[model samples]
Target chain A: MSTWTSDAAALRSTWFLRGVRAAFSLPGLILVSSFIGFAALAKDAGVTMAQAAFMTGTVWALPSMVVLVGAIGSGAALPAAMFAVTLSAIRLMPMVMALAPEMRTGKTRQCVLYLLAHFVAVTSWVLAMERLKRVPPPMRTTYYAGLGGTLVTTNVIVVTVVYAVADALPSAVSAALLMLTPMYFLTSLWGSARERAGHVAMVLGLVLGPVFHIVLPQIDLLVAGLIGGTVAYGLQLWRRKVRAA
Target chain B: MFILVAGFAATDIWRFLGVYLGGKLSEDSDLLVLVRTMATALVAAVIGNLIVFPGGALAHTSLDLRIAAAALGFVGYLVSGKRMVVGIATAESLLLAGLYLNF
Candidate 1:
C-alpha cells in the first residue's frame, strides 16, 4: 500500500523545497516578467478575467498565451486563435521529447508523463533540464513538478492581479504594458535562436508573415510558417550534406 | 473554456505526443528537425505580426516607431549578452517614450 509513500513525502518536502528555491532565482524572475507582460497584453486585448485565467492556467506557455490574445484581438475566428496558440506550442514538443527521458526510469508508463508535459514551457524546460541534473534520476519529475507548479501558480496569480488592476490604470500606462508582450517575445527569442537554421527560419518568417497577412489576413500565419520553416529545414539539410561531402 | 479545451489542450497534445515518440527516435532524425524548424518559423511569424500587422494598441503606433523599437531591442539584446529583460526594457522604454513624446 505504501510502495511510494515515502517517495511522495520526500518529493513534496525536500525535492519540492529544492525546486521552489531554484524557481525563486533566475527562472522565476524571467517567468514573472514574461507573464506580467502577457497579463498586460491580455488586458489591452480586452480579455476577461475568466479568459485570462484559463489561458494562464492551461496555456501556460507565455508565447502561446500572448499569441492567442493577439489572434483573437485581431478579430480572428475561434479556430484561428486556437491555431496560432497551437503553433506557438510546437516548440515545446521537441523540448519535452528531449527532456522526458531524464525524468522517468524503468518501464513505467505511469500517467505522470501527461501531467508533466504541461510543465514543458521554455523556462521550466531550460531550467529543469539544467538543474534537474543535480537531482537523483528518480526524483527529477518531483523536482520539476515543484518548479513548474510554482511558476504556473505565480503566473495565474500575477495574471489575476494585473488584470484586476488594469482597468483602473490610465490608458497610456496600460498600453506600455501591452507593448511589453512583443518586446519580451522578440528579445527572449533572440537568445533561443542560437543556431544558423533558427536564425534563417526567424528571418524568413519575419519577412514573409506580414506579407502573407496582407495578402490573406485569415490564414497567413499558418501558410508563412509552412513555407518558411520548410525552407529553413531544407537549407539546414543541404548545409549538412555539403559539410559531409 | 475555449482557451482550456482548444488553446492549452491543443498545445499539450504535442508535448504528450513528443514524450511518446522521443524515447524511440533519434533527435538527429529528419522528422524531429523539421518539426523544430516549423516551431521556430511559427514563433517568427508571431513576431512579425506583432511588429508589423499587430492588433490592439500597437496597431495605432506608426511603422517607423515600431521598426526603431525593434532595432533598439535587437541591439540591446546583443549588447546585454542576450539578457531578455534588458532588451525588452530598452525597446519598451523607447516605444513608450516615443508614444509619450508624440502625444
Candidate 2:
C-alpha cells in the first residue's frame, strides 16, 4: 500500500501539473479551434454531427476527417474513402515514433502505451518533443498524459459545440473558422522548427506537399513526407561536412 | 461500421506499430534521429496539405488571404516571445477579417 501511494504521487507530480498547465495554453487553444473547425467542415460536407464528433474522437487527424467526409459526400465507394482516410494517417507513424521514446518509464506499462499513442497527433507530438527534455524521465509519461488529455478533452467539447451550431454561423464565418486548424499548423510548425534541417524540411514540404496533392491525391502525404524528409536530412548532413571542410 | 473499423484501424495500426518500434531504440541511437527528422518532415507535409489542398469551406477561400494570415501568425509568434496563442489569434483574426471584408 505504501509503495502504491508513492508511485501514484510520483506519477502525478509537479511535472505532470506543469504539463497540464502548458497544454492549457496555446496548444490547447490550437486544438480546440482546429477541432471546432473540423466539426463545422465535416458537417458542411454532409456528415452528421455525431459522426463528425466520432471522427474527431477516433481518427484525431484533421486531414483524414476532411478526406473521409469529402469521400462520403461525393458518393465515392466506401473502400476508397476508407483507403484515403488511412493514407492521410501515415504521417502519424513518424509522429508516434518520435513521441514514444520519451514517454517510456519504469512506472509506465506497455499496455498504457497503446492508449497514449491514440493521442499522438501533430500538436501534441510537437509540443512533447520540444518540452519533454525539461521533464524527468520517470514522470514523462504522466506529463504526456496531462498534456494529451487536456487537448483531447477540449477537442471533444469543441467538436460537439461546433457541430451543434455549425448551421447558425454564416458560410463565410464557418469557412474562415475552418482555416484555423491549418493556420495554427502553419505558425506552430514554423515556430517549432528548432534546427536548420527542420526548416529545410518545412520549405521542401511546403512545395512538395501541395504539388504531390495535386498530382497524386491518394498518397500525397506518404510520398511527400518520405522524399522531403530524406532530402532535408541529406542536406543538413552535407552542410555540416562543408562547414567541417 | 465499415468506415469506423477500416478508417480507425488503418490509422490506429500505425500508432501501435510505432510504439513497439520506438520503445526498442535507445535515446542516443542514430536511428532515433532519423525518426525525429521524419516526424518533423511529416508535420510540415501535413501543414502544407492543409494550406494548399484543404477540402472544405477553407478550400473555397482565396489562397492569398490564407497565406497572408499565416505569414502574420508566424511573425506574431516570433514577435511575441514565441507565444503560440498570440500568434494563432493574430492569424485567425486576420483570416476572419480578410474573409469578412472580401466576401
Candidate 3:
C-alpha cells in the first residue's frame, strides 16, 4: 500500500516536470509559428476574433481550421468544408499510435490517456517520443501530460494574439503567415530524415508530387505519398533482407 | 464553410476521442503499424501534392520555380546537417527570388 501511494506521487511529479519542459521546447515553438497562420486565416475570412479564438481552443488542429476558414471564406458548402477538414485530420489516427505507447501502464492509466490525447499534435508527439524513450515507464505518463498541458497553454496564447491582430496585417505579411503552416511541416520532415529510407521517402514525395499532379491532379498527393512511401518502405525491407543474406 | 466547420468538428472529435483511446491501444499491434505507414504515406502524399499541384498562393508560381525552391530547400537541409529552419528558409528565399525574377 505504501509503495502504491509513493509510486502514484512520483508519477504525478515527473509528469509535472515534463509539462514544464514542454513549455520551453521545440514543439512549443512550432505550435506558435503555425498559429500565426491560423490567425491570419481567421482574420482574412472575416471570422470574429472571438470565434477564431474559440476555434483554436477547441479544434486545436491547424489544417482543419484552415480548411474550415477557407471554405467559409470561399463560400464552399458546409459538407465540403467538413470533409476537407476530416481528410486533413486522418493523420491523427497514426499520431494516436505513436503517442499512446508513451502513456501505457495498465487498465487504469488507459482512462488518463484518453483524457490526455486531446493535446496530441506533431510537436507534442515528437517531443514526447523523444523524452519518453529515455525515462522510466512509470514517469512517462506524467511527462506527456505536462508537455501536452504546456502546449495547450501556448496555443491558447498564440491564437489570442493572432486573432486580435488579424485585421491589421498587410497582404504580404498575411500571405507569408499562411505559408508558414506548410513550411513548418516541410522543414520538420527534413529534420526527421535521419535514416536513408526517410530521406528517400521525402525526396520521392517531393519529386513525384509535381509529376503526378500534372498527369492526374485529383489524386496527386495520394498517389505520390503511396508510391513514395511504399517504395521507401519496400526498399528498406529489401536492403535489410539482402544484408541478412 | 459548413464543410470547414464539419471538418473542424470531425478532427476535434477525434482529438477528444484520443484522450479516451490513448491508454487503451497497444503499441505493438499490427493495426498500429498499418496506421503508422498509412499516416506517413498520407503526409508524403500531401507534401507531394502541394509541391506538384499547388493551389492558392503556391499555384501562382511556375512548376519549375516551385521545384527549384523545394530542391534548394532540400539541399540546404542536407548541407546544414538537417536543420529544419535552414531548409524552410532556403525554400522561402528561393521562392521569393523566383517571384522577383518573374515580376
Candidate 4:
C-alpha cells in the first residue's frame, strides 16, 4: 500500500511538471503576447485592471473577452453583450468535445473532467491535442491541469502588470505580437494534422471564412465550419470507399 | 459583475456539455472525427478572419503584408521540420521589418 501510494504520487508530479514545462514553450509565449495586447485594448475600453484580469480568468477565451470588452466600451445593453459573447464562444464546444475524450480514462472522475474542461480554450486545446497522444491516458488530465492552470495564472499576472505600467503599445509592435497567434495556429495545425481531411478542412475554412464574413457576418464561423468540415469529411469517406472498391 | 456572470455561463456551458457528451463516446468513433473536423475548421475560420479582417493594432498593417508574413511563416514552419517557434519568429520578424521599411 505504501509503495502504491508513492508510485501514484510520483506519477502525478512527473506528468504535472511535464505539463508545466510545456507551458513555457512557443504556444505559451504566444498566449502571453496576445494577452498583453488584450490588456491594452481593455484599458482603452475603460475596463479596470481588476475587471480585465477577472475577464481574462473567467472568460478565458480571448475572442469572447474581446467581445465583452467591446460591448462594454460601446455602452451596449447587458443582454446584447451576453448574446454576442455567447455566439462568439460557440466554437469552444467542438474544441472541448475534441479534447475531452483525449483526456478521459475509465477511472477518471466526471468532476475532474469538469474542472479541466474550464481550460479548453483555443491555445490550450491545440497544445493538449498536440501533446496528449504521447501522454499516458491516466496522466493526461493531470498534464492538462498543470498546463492550463499555469497559463491562466501567468496571464492574470501579466495582464494586471501590463495594464498598470505600459503605455499603449506601438501599433506595429502590437500588430506583430497579435499576429503570432494566428501564425502559430496555422503552422501548428498544418504540422500536427493527423490526416489529409484535416488539411482539407483547414483550407476550406480558410477560404470560406472570409466569404461568409462578407455574405453573412454574424454566423460566419458557424456556417464555414459546418460546410467545410462536412465537405472535407465527405471527401475522406469517398476516398476510403474508392480504396476499398 | 454582469460581465462575469454572463461571460462565464455563456462560455462554460459548452465546455460542460462537451465533457458530458464526450464522456459518452469512444475516442475513435466516427462522431468524434466529425466533431474534431468541425473544431479544426472552426479554428481555421477564426485564423482566416483574424488575418483578413483584423481589429485594433493588426488592422494598421496592410492586408498584403499580413498575408505575406503568414505565407512565409507557414513555409518556414514546413521547412524547419515544423518547429513552431521558427515559424512564429520568421513571421513576426518579417512583419516588423515590413512595418519599419514601409513595405
Top DockQ prediction, candidate number: 1
| Number of clashing residue pairs, candidate 2 | 0
- Write down the DockQ of candidate 4: 0.56
lDDT of 4: 0.80
Restricted to chain B, the TM-score per model reads 0.84, 0.74, 0.74, 0.80
Docking level of model 1: medium
What does the lDDT read for residue A148 in candidate 3? 79
- Off-target runs (Cα >4 Å) in candidate 4 are A1-22, A37-51, A62-109, A121-144, A163-166, B1-7, B21-23
**Where does model 3 sit among the CAPRI classes?**
acceptable
Model number with the top TM-score: 1
Can you give the lDDT of residue A155 in candidate 1?
82
After superposition, the stretches of candidate 2 with alpha carbons farther than 4 Å from their true spots are A1-24, A63-107, A123-150, A192-194, B2-6, B26-46, B53-60
Q: Give the TM-score of candidate 1.
A: 0.89
- The best-first sequence of candidates by lDDT reads 4, 1, 2, 3
lDDT tens string, model 3, A22-43? 6686567766877876676577
For candidate 2, what is the DockQ-based docking class?
acceptable
Each prediction's fraction of true contacts recovered: 0.66, 0.55, 0.38, 0.66
Model 3, residue A241: distance off in Å is 9.2
Clash count per candidate? 0, 0, 17, 0
What's the true lDDT of residue A36 in model 1? Answer: 70
Summing lDDT over every window of 10 consecutive residues in candidate 1 chain B, give the lowest-scoring window. B50-59
Q: Which stretches of candidate 1 lie over 4 Å from their true place?
A: A1-12, A74-80, A107-109
The predicted structure with the larger DockQ, 2 or 4, is 4
- lDDT per residue, candidate 4, A1-245, as tens digits? 56544545566889899899889987788778778767876776789998999998898988678667766876777877777567557657667778988887889899999999998887888889899887777888999999999999999999999888655566776677568657866886676566788899899988888898899776667678788888888888899999999
Cand. 3 TM to true fold? 0.70
lDDT of 3 by residue, B1-103 (tens): 3433575467766665555565577644544433344335545555655555544445566778776777788789779987767777787777777777773
